[model samples]
Target: MEVRKLHPLFAAELIGADVSDPQNRELIDTVEDAMREYAVLCIRGQGHINDQQQLAFARAFGPLELPPGNNAPGVKSRIAPGLYSASNLDANGEIVALESRSAKIAKGNELFHADSSFNDMPSKWSILRGVIIPPERGDTQFIDMRAVYEALPQAMKDRIADLKAEHSYAHSRRKAGADADDNLPMFKYMRAVQPMVKQSPSGRPTLFVGAHAERVIGMDEEEGTALIEELLAFAEQPQFIYSHKWQPGDIVIWDNRCTLHRGTEFDYLRYKRDMRRANVNESGEERCAIPAEALTQHYQQLSKAEAAN
Candidate 1:
């Protein structure tokens, strides 16, 4: 397998390796190494991969994550329980109407985010395969947060160093006006605290704020959102971005710890685009959930304090 760097800041495209083969254990190690170094690895030309084969390759990174309840029931993905659909097509293989629930969910992808950041144990890596490609203008863009952090002024760095923020799927969903709560059992209302500046697995200090991040701890709502928006604006400089155009059978795997990504729109009404993704947790990291009891106590205390104030 030959690895070619796609950008100076982050992504690399690997040629000549087929990820679908289970016997190719050696490729997993190679890909992992590249992922750590490049942050984004696109393995081209695997368009014929079946759902089982895609799952097999994704699991090589770590255990898979189940789709969030927000995906809704009755909208079946080919690789369910582990794989999540990233497409606009419904279970019946027809393009969903623009105002439909599935389409609204897909619209949420327009915001820059790291997958599953609302979970205590956020996704370590994500693998996406393009099964059907639109003719033009549907690209997945990624940003290197490590590079973004490095480029920041020292004062800006110090300001965020000790800060923490809360991440919630509800916040992101609402951003795109996709909050049509269907009361699905799988819908986990998650809010987890993460360092505003986190140490990546590669040992670099990286910015962690994204679409799911609601507010910074200890800061008022307006102030916190302003700071988050400032950081987002600073990080989106073109030099740190890598936009990957889709091709059928293209497999793109990215390290979620140090990268932010968002899907670009196409002619959703006219074109059929099918993409499936699997999210994997870091090795040896067990699934973590914030205790409901603890959350309740914390909120009660906050309410009491506010009442006194």
Candidate 2:
């Protein structure tokens, strides 16, 4: 396989490898290593892979993260088993209307974030496959957090070296004004005291702040928020971004531990976009930050209360 770097700091394109071929163990190993070296990697010319094939390829990295039960009611994934439906379509395959709550909350994708960072054991990698591509205006942009961390002023780096932040799915949803307090089910995710910078296995430092990071520990909420905003703005400078214009059959996977990504606006009502993703958790690292049974029981009681009301 041939690798070409897409940006100066990170991201690469892999050529001459059919990822769907499970027996291509050598290719898989090479691809995985390339992913570690370059945080974002894309494989083109895969327009025909089925959902099963996509899952198989993603599993080569690690165990897949299934659609969590903690998702809100309208948030049911359209795909089977483990794939996430990152689409503008309903379960019936119709385009979700712009005014719908699901569409509204999905708009939060405009903000840079790493998938599942609110989980204590955050995602290690995310493989997204483009199924239906819009003609224009839906590019996905990625940020190399390692480059961002490296460029930070020494004092700034020192200040955040040991700081921790809280990240919450509910907080982000509420900020999008998607009716998180009422229509949304009780969210069972809240990650507290996550270090502001994560150290990768190779000793590279990556900035971990994003929209889900609500506040920094040991600082006033307002002060923490301002700092988070400032960091986000600084990190998103044009030089640090690599925007991928989508093409049908394109599969882009990025290391969640060292990158931030966001989706750009498109003519949603007129155009339909279909994308599926499988997030791989860190190998041998699973956090029961909130016990599954406890979250289930709490939501069960919440459902009963809502029904009675």
Candidate 3:
């Protein structure tokens, strides 16, 4: 199988391999490397994969996360809702126009963000498949945090170099006029304080801002929040985005470790959507202060790997 780079910053298309091919180590590594370098991947031709097959494919990257309690049918503890479920029917499993608010919430995720940014232990990766997609309605979007980091002004970069942010899922959910806290498990009050601008452990630059970034460390609450909102806007420029229009046989794998993303809200009232997702973990990822200089090196390694086979 071969991988095609979609952008110099992030995103790729895996066109020459099958994911459910018995868990080959090299292929898994190749996929992981692609995700590390590109952050997001769209793979076509997979109409035959079922839940078990989907879950199996996702497990290749890591473990699955439990679904949040507010999820629809087929929701599990670690699985993210599929990209197409935005307009799917729950009753009799008919899957028509998306009816649930939870489903609509999925549609509004087009913004860049780390998965579960609201949680202290956010998920590390996500695998989503388009089980049913409208001819033109349900495209998934992605952005390159690493690229955003690279583009920051030196003064701004240095200003945020040692800063950290508070990420809270409940906070964002509440602002959406929804109750997210009741669904997520409660933990110690302490939240994730990851660097506002992180250099991935692999020595890649990664900006960690997202919709869920509630505040910054050591700053007044009001000021920190304003800062968070301002930066999140800057990171989500149209030039930084790649939107994926789906086909039934298409699958997507993304890295949450280095990028933040949101699902776009579409005309779920007019089209049916159903998707399945599986997730992997990086809850145990070691946080470090070292900045990566492998920006170009990482991209080269991934492209080379893609060419090798």
Candidate 1's displacement at residue 165, Å, is: 0.4
- TM-score of model number 3: 0.78
Greater-TM-score candidate between 1 and 2:
2
Inter-residue clash pairs, candidate 2: none
After TM-score superposition, the amount by which residue 139's alpha carbon in candidate 2 deviates from its true location, in angstroms, is 0.5
Would you list the C-alpha lDDT of every candidate in the order shown? 0.82, 0.82, 0.66
Q: What is candidate 1's lDDT per residue for 260-307, written digit by digit as tens?
A: 999998999999998988778864543324344444543455457558
Error of 2 at 188 (Å): 3.2
In candidate 2 the C-alpha lDDT for residue 225 amounts to 93
Compute the lDDT for candidate 2. 0.82
Tens-place lDDT per residue, model 3, 1-309, is 788988766789987777777468877888877777777888889887777777677766655564433232233332233222333556455544444555544533544567665555557788888777877755677877778788888887888888998776556555555434432323123146667876764588778888767789899999898878877777888878887888897888878777766666656666666777666766554321112322233334534755895
305 in model 2: Cα distance from truth in Å? 10
Q: Please give the distance, in angstroms, between residue 201's alpha carbon in candidate 2 and its true position after superposition.
A: 3.9
